[model samples]
Target: MTSSAVDPVRLAGERRRIFLALFSALAIALHALEFLLPSPVPWFRLGFANIFALLALFLYDGRAAWSVNMVRIVVASLFLGTFFSPRFFLSLSGGILATLAMTTSRKLGCEKIGPVGVSVLGACGHSVGQLLCAWWLIVRHDGVWFLLPPLLLIALVTGIINGFVADALLQRLRRHPPFEDIADGAHSDV
Candidate 1:
């Protein structure tokens, strides 16, 4: 194929891969950074890394979001020496559910929901996922239920913060031709 004749289909796929990889690294970095900060609530993280997954989901799709999330969890866990541990599983479950919630909300709400709504839902999902896992694996007691109220409230606050960040980034990134070019067929099967 001529240089100008380069297949858009292949090009789009390549661009997506590149973005996914970049998102994963960014997520990992943020995850590590959050780990260093002292938690206001015990065992609670600000979840700064999820912005990239949200970005990937909006710019691409759920699969891309999942890829970024999974990579972030696995790589960050390994880096933090938590790989193959309960903490890793907790992180894994939370990331999985968060991405799912975001993707589902986006699909169901369509034009009605913006980044904030999607992100809030995702954050709530992540908290619920981790809470359930803790109840099942660690706490195994009814008393663990008390954590829900606080966790959900935290999730709401954190989600709104993350959502606003994602919203600002999305607005700016969408205006970018290179990003927009690859994202042109974002809704299409690539």
Candidate 2:
């Protein structure tokens, strides 16, 4: 094929891959940075890495969001030497639940709720998923239930903070050509 005659399918696939790589890198960096910080409580993460997943959900589609999330989880785990470990599974489950919740809310015409609301929902989902994972694998008792209220509160605060950050990022990105293209619905399949 001529250089100018790029296949549309191939072009779309390439774009998706490139975007996924970029998003994954951002997530991995954020995850690493967060890991370096000392937390007062064990198993407590600010979840800043998820902002990129949320960005993908809004900029692309559910598939793209999930792709970004999974790539981030796997690659970050590998980098941190946590791959296939219990911690890896916990992170994976929480990330999956959060991405699913946010993407589903977006796809269901919940735009009125905006990113903030979606983020809170995703945060709640993430907390619940992680708690469930802990309950099953570590706690193995009803005592784990006691952590829910506090965890949910933390999630809400972090979600709002992250949501504002994502919203700001999206506002600026929307002015750019690629994001504008997506906003114009040109990448409906994305």
Best by lDDT: 1
Backbone clashes counted, model 2? 0
| lDDT value for model 2 | 0.81
What lDDT would each prediction earn against the true structure? 0.86, 0.81
> Which ranges of candidate 2 are over 4 A from the true structure?
1-13, 184-187
How does model 1 score by TM-score? 0.93
C-alpha lDDT of residue 58 in model 2: 78
Alpha-carbon TM-score of each model against the true structure: 0.93, 0.89
C-alpha lDDT (0 to 100) for residue 45 of candidate 2:
86
lDDT of 2 by residue, 63-180 (tens): 8888888888898899999998998888888888898888878777545657788788899889988888888987799898899999999999999988989889888888875455
**How does model 2 score by TM-score?**
0.89
Model 1 stretches with alpha carbons more than 4 Å out = 1-3, 182-186
